[model samples]
Target: MTRRTPSTSHRRHQRGVSLFGLLFWAIVVGFFGYLAVVVFPTVNEYFTIKRAVDKIAAEAPATVPEVRAAFERQRAIEYSISSIGSNDLEITKENDRLVIGFAYEKEIPIVGPVYLLLKYEGRSGQ
Candidate 1:
């Protein structure tokens, strides 16, 4: 049996990505990263609002107005909330428990004249 050495062509066929390919992937990753940075805050804010509402629901207020007032108080203390208000809530009663529901939209500007509208909804009872 004869043993043959590997050809130079085989060695020349290098592995891994090219500079351009690397740059392209970097840009793609960077874009999604920036998108996450922009979008995450909105989602986080929605969750914060949801948590506050849940707290109010857990307290089990006596009436719809009282529910709104409780939320208003929470919002006053929690400076992170700016998009929601008492009027925005959908108050109802279920199983003799106060349920506070709300739906709102957040407009996030990604670039010039381009915005992302995030719609968020939650119920305090759930």
Candidate 2:
């Protein structure tokens, strides 16, 4: 009986990623990182606005005008809020409880001539 040796071709093949594959992955990661950097502030601002609205809702104002005034006061104290105003709010009452609703859009520059538009909506109750 004769025994055959292992083929050299099997050993000659290389494994793992190539230089081009590495570069492509690097670019993909970089793009996501950039997107996060551009998007985080807008999300943060949305939360801040939500908090302010919640605070006003908790106050349970008796009138719509009072709600607007309270929001304006909060906005004045919060320098981060520039995209919203008293007129932007939708005020209503349910079960003798004040409900405030607001919606706004924020445009963030991702790159030259490229922008990301984020839509934010908030309600005081629930």
Best model number under lDDT: 2
State TM-scores per candidate: 0.86, 0.86
In candidate 1, what are the lDDT values of residues 4-85, reduced to their tens digit?
5685224566799999999999999998999999988788888889999999989988887888899899999888888899
- Candidate 2 regions off by >4 Å? 1-9
Which clashing pairs does model 2 show? none
Structure candidate 1, residue pairs in collision: none
Compared with the true structure, what per-residue lDDT tens digits does model 2 show for residues 1-126?
A: 655556623455679999999999999999999989888877887888899999999988888899999999998998888888999999988787788999999888877998888888989867
* Number of clashes recorded per candidate: 0, 0
- Report, for every candidate in turn, its global Cα lDDT versus the true structure: 0.87, 0.88
**Deviation from native of the Cα of residue 95 in model 1, angstroms:** 2.0
Which residues of candidate 1, in runs, are more than 4 Å off?
A: 1-12
- For model 1, how many clashes? 0
lDDT of 1: 0.87
